[model samples]
Target: MGLVKIRVEGVSKVFGRDPAGALAKVRSGMDKTRLKDETDHVLGLHDIDLSIRTGEIFVIMGLSGSGKSTLIRHFNRLIEPTGGRILFDGDDILAYDAARLQTFRRRKVAMVFQRFALLPHKTVIENVAYGLTLDGVAKPEAFRRAGEQIALVGLTGFETSYPAQLSGGMQQRVGLARALATDAEVLLMDEAFSALDPLIRHDMQMQLKELQGRLGKTIVFITHDLDEALLLGDHIAILKDGTLRQVGTGSEILAAPADDYVARFVRDVNRGRILLCGAFADAGLIAAADAPVIAADATLESTFAAFAGGAAALAVRDWDGRIAGALTPRRVMEALARI
Candidate 1:
């Protein structure tokens, strides 16, 4: 994990008249249901506190009305908080003037919406270059930068094609490419892959992981899908009824939920696919001389096939290829059972 890039501090949002009064009642132990019933104000978020690290994929997720989208919008100040502060690199963004905020939106953060928000009449390159053009970059320079982003997103040959002619996945790629073209340090993706077919969604997820590995952009991704959250998030934050329930790595949350709501939320997740072998490895155990070696980062699901070879234990190697520990069949079974 890198240093904190975006910090959300005690942020609360209420959608109705007199948000301040509703926030006061909320601070005085009133819940969302009560606030809504009494004041006719909807609690969109309550005291959401988080630290998003530099160059990490921070996922904010929940079911409908969980305030996941509302919370993400706060990062770029799309939705003003009823109270609290939003800081970017230790500077309070809520304090930014209109001109400063506009610059921040253009140069510091870019957003990819759930819908492919591309111009139907514009070609792929034209759409990708839209941000730069809006910022007054010359046509030739903007097109050159946009061309690079188009290729980066694997849309090289589709530069001249309009969005209406492209498939849903391709349109989304154009959206992603557009965000990338701005060279913004942070990318806010609000359910970027939710509209694609299952196979295409999976492909886009993999491509995003690969892109993050290379570009090292700080990405804040919002989703309602647990699988997608686990697959992408370096740190996952779960919300319910506009309140933060828990925040941790996927393995940490799967292994130990903070509350009953979170416990129920992750009850059906495939633990073997999320829990890493390193967490279950026995540092004191000795592996057989001829035991199979597996990477420490390998998921428990991937290690099952190695265990099927009749090895008593598999040697787990760290990134540097040194034996970190040994993982036995019994240990794997115990870990899975605990979850």
Candidate 2:
């Protein structure tokens, strides 16, 4: 609920020569598939309305061709929209000409790709410094800044290694480092961790969460995996066939799905992992609370581990260590059942 960093209003994209007619048809209640089949116009997005908050991880998730990638490209104007407009910090992005758009891309935002887009010939240090170099930072100063980012990403000694010499995860870290070196206000990550192995992907997810907490960068992350979105996103936007289906926190999405598509999508999800400790706590049940105090932000997984020895209820405390609410095993199970 801070200031809005990016606002997308009534955004729609149709890829074809005669987009005006197709868009008019769409507004008249025509669907995307029928339009494509009957009019030969492809609908890449339809009325996408989103507000990305400052310094928060806003995740856009859907299967391939769902317009998740296309929607994000508009943040940096990579793909010109057939209709609608986007606002960044109150400035109209769509109205920017070539020079202003270039400056916006260089200073306001940096992107990390699905593939590790590192230079095969350049050393890791060189790749990380490339963005700064492009912005006209002197070589010595650029290297100094890039070296700090490389260390921040835990790739200190391997700065001399080439992309081929590093592992997939390491290369991905290089991509992250390169983006960080730019010192941009926002990070647009399009399925950045999807290419890694499952274990490595999870590790990267945790690292990104920690880094976000420390750096407070506004990150717009794209993903196809529901679990990854639930784990990493402060707010999640679900897209289906180029249309937005739902937008809310993970718990909100789980407790109340907006439509049948969303309901079926989350029907088999492991809800226990995503539910937080705050969900199970009820202040009125203080007398029933018989266990140790736990942090309000702790997840059910950690609660289970902490109370593994018994079935006692726990007392939840706020950041200042003051009693906030009471938690019970039964309440936790009941919350999971609702999901």
Candidate 3:
């Protein structure tokens, strides 16, 4: 994890004519269901506290009405909280003036919506360059940057293609390219892949992971799908009923759920795919000199072929390249057997 890029403290949002009053009631121990029934005020979020690290994919996930989308919008101040403070790099963004906020939205953060909000008539390059043009960048410079982004997103030949002419996945690539063209430090993706077909969504997820590895943008990805969240997020925050349920790495949450709700949420997940070798490895055991080596962060599923090849045990090496421990085939099966 990098330095904290965005910090959300005591953030709560209520939607109604009497937002302040509703917030007060919420703080005074009114649950979301009762508050809504009594005041007709929807609790969008409740006391959300989060730290989004720089250059990491932070995923917020939940079912419908879980406030995942609401929480993400707070980062760019698209929707202000009724109470609490949002800080960007230790500076309170909630205090920004209109002009400062405009600059912050344009230069610091970019968003990719679920529906691929591209201009219908605009060509791919033009759509990608739209943000820069809004920032008063000259046409030539904006077009050049946009062209680079288009190519970066594997849409090199589609610069002149209109959104209507492109497939759903291609249109989404245009959305991503447009966000990247702005050179924003952070990317806010709200259900960005949810609109695509399953295969296309999987492809987009892989592309996003690859892009994050190379660009190192602080990405806040909102998804309702647990699989997508585990695949992309360096750290995942689970929300329920407008309240934060838990926040941790996917493996951490899988190994030890914060509560029964979280446990049930993760009950169907494939443990072998999420649990790391280091967590399951035996520190007391040592691997043979000829044993296969796997990274500590490698998923247990990735070691199956080695185990099938008659390797009784594999050496688990950490990120720093030191042998952390040895992972045996029996341990892998034991982990898979765990619900």
- Report each candidate's C-alpha RMSD, comma-separated, in the order given: 1.4, 2.1, 1.5
Q: Tell me model 3's lDDT, rounded to 2 decimals.
A: 0.94
TM-score of each predicted structure versus truth:
0.96, 0.92, 0.96
Lowest-lDDT window of 10 residues in candidate 3? 330-339
Q: Rate the local accuracy (lDDT) of all candidates.
A: 0.94, 0.91, 0.94
Report the lDDT tens digits of candidate 1 across residue range 26-124. Answer: 999998888889899999999989999999999999998999999989989999999999999999999999999988998899999999889988999
Worst 10 residues of 2 by lDDT: 285-294
lDDT (Cα, tens digit) per residue for candidate 3, span 108-214: 99999999999998999999999999999999999999999999999999999899999999999999999999999999999999999999999999999999999
> Predictions ranked by TM-score, top down?
1, 3, 2
Candidate 2 clashes between residue pairs 3 or more apart in a chain or in different chains: none
**Is candidate 2 or 3 superior in lDDT?**
3
- Candidate order by lDDT, highest to lowest? 3, 1, 2
Provide the clash count, candidate 3: 0
Question: Which pairs of residues clash in candidate 3, taking residues 3 or more apart in a chain or in different chains?
Answer: none
Please give the lDDT score at residue 38 for candidate 1: 88
